[model samples]
Target: MLRGLATINFYADDVEAAKDWYAELLGVEPYFEGPGEGGTTAYYEFRIGDHQTELGLIDRRYAPPGLPAAPGGAIGHWHVDDVRGTLDRLLAMGAAPYTPLTEYGSGFVTASVTDPFGNVLGIMYNEHYLEMLGLR
Candidate 1:
């Protein structure tokens, strides 16, 4: 069982540049830097509020094979207190929903959307029953 979304890892061509861009976008600098392998490559992380969910920047050159190229934005779904309200705010800020909300099963709702930069985002919430099942 998990508490919530932990972190999102992104590959970047230039780690420093990507970190700077995300720092500006998120309005928060990295709070922690991982230990590099011989000071060569490492990850940069920023926290989301008080949660463990983080935005991570990783080195593209050192990434495993079969993974997408560097500087490629990754899609991540985030749960909010109010999906409609959050959608409205994001829309006003230039985000667009790719798909309308739909019910997956008992007490589960999901929607697909895209940020201004083209990164896909999913929004979802669990019903009380699902929460009781520890799926939230």
Candidate 2:
């Protein structure tokens, strides 16, 4: 049975750069780093946002076989109060636009940006999410 989101992993050619870039964007440092197969750090993790959802970065060399090098897939969007503002901030931080801000009716809005590491970072302002979190 499926539960809540555990971790969203992003592949990067340089794990350290990805960690530093996400640290600046999220305003927090990675809480965990992997010793990897040979004692080199090949992975890093950060627990972020209200639910402490995990965001991870793994070295591309460790990526599974058949994984595409291009950035495109099912993005897991995080809830935010200001989708546009968050998108703007990410863009200012050198993130490329993946999905422009769009209203989804009934007060729902969503957007996304592609990080320098080629991962899509999704953002959304959802009333349903706030209600579920008891934040409404």
Which has the greatest lDDT? Answer: 2
Which residue runs of candidate 2 sit more than 4 Å off their true CA positions? none
Clashing pairs in 2: none
What digit string (tens of lDDT, one per residue) describes model 1 on residues 1-136? 9766678776666777767766764578899887666775478998874355787777766667887432234445566657777667666666667878777787567666655544456666657634655666
Off by over 4 Å in 1: 1-6, 10-44, 49-51, 57-75, 128-136
TM-score of each: 0.53, 0.95
Best by TM-score: 2
**Each model's lDDT:** 0.66, 0.92
lDDT of 2 by residue, 1-136 (tens): 9888999999999888999999998899999989776778999999998889999999999999998888898988999899988998999999999988999898799999899999988999999989988978
- CA shift at 65, candidate 2, in angstroms? 0.4
lDDT of candidate 2 at residue 87, scale 0 to 100: 91
lDDT of 2: 0.92
